[model samples]
Target: MDLATIWVTFTSWAGAYSWQVIVTLAIVGLYFLIDRLTIPVLSRSADNARLTESSGDRAVGLARLLTGTLCALAMMVVWGVQFGSVLVFAGTALTLLGVALFASWSILSNITAYFVILLHPTFRRGTFIRVLDADNYAEGYIADLGLFNLKLITENREAIVYPNNLLLGRPCVINPRDRLRGVGKLPPLPPLDVVPNNE
Candidate 1:
């Protein structure tokens, strides 16, 4: 190659390459647009499915990660890497992809744990949770339900972080559900019309 061609190809930053920048931006933009458009549509479709429902978060997370990787690789090519280096780039990309997936899984797992706790009939902010398999117990108000762990404030006011998987397996004492049945005889109330006369 000519001296000028070689210099431009090997030494120019990715931003200096007009075509690369344009193409990469276009792909990234399209990826975001498509993601935004498909999410609600797919969620609706899944809602209609009788047998099962898919987690929109998981699908969206996967798409965003893969698309971002593609954008990064496009930038790398613009940096003038040789064709023979593509395999190396591919391997690097795969490593990055694995890491991203691992992190996403961790976050998703934590979020799922909190959701399970909120759904239990007897679980409330101040309820106690006891794991059947594990010999641990968390008592106090449920401070926060995180994706990977439960944030519980014990009676002594200590914060506890319990893994999502463990929280899922634990049995919760649901106050509302347990209290739904008649506990015993109730005190008699005066006539409802007379009691509300002030209002």
Candidate 2:
């Protein structure tokens, strides 16, 4: 072969190989960026959903819902339909499911925050609470003793939902004065004189 012809053939092959390498590198860079950033950001909504209940079923249930949602979203994205093909109805369904889960969590979290802030003054921290006209009596941690209601999680794993109206009428006491109240070592309540129920 002539010297010029050989040189031309080698240059053409090198140009093609360089283009392929550039495309490959771009794909790899995108994959790593999504894995490191996108997944974590998407998973955070789940954590925000579990805003209430320091140690009760509601909190645990929220956690489970959050985990399930993140897993489902990841699966859908990974298994999404390819270009030029119709998107599956299943993908839409999964997206709706994720939205619903997030909505419910947000509503519940807001309710908990509202209850805590409204009932703050009368409801001090570390106070053992008994709800009148209710089956729940929270007594472990004054997780958040608020104005509208007293948020207490008992040692037995039950959250006592005491309303502001009820707490306002009944007298109570507290033991601590901090933002975070740990479980156990709850202060005792003064003995109340309850008349026998003549039902």
lDDT of 2 by residue, 60-136 (tens): 34444555554444444444435223245546765765564334343333434443333344433544444332322
Question: Could you tell me the lDDT of residue 196 within candidate 2?
Answer: 100
After superposition on all CA atoms, what RMSD does each candidate show versus the true structure?
A: 14.8, 13.7
Q: Local error of candidate 2 at 154, Å? A: 2.5
For model 1, what is the error of residue 130's alpha carbon versus the real structure, in angstroms, after optimal superposition?
4.8
Q: For residues 67-119, write the lDDT of model 1, one tens digit per residue.
A: 67776676667657775597687888678656643443454554545444444
Native-to-model Cα distance after best TM-score fit, residue 126 in candidate 1, in Å: 7.7
Q: Which parts of model 2 are misplaced by more than 4 Å?
A: 1-27, 37-86, 89-94, 105-199
TM-score of each: 0.38, 0.25
The candidate that achieves the highest TM-score relative to the unseen native structure: 1
Off by over 4 Å in 1: 1-22, 31-70, 78-132, 145-149, 164-199
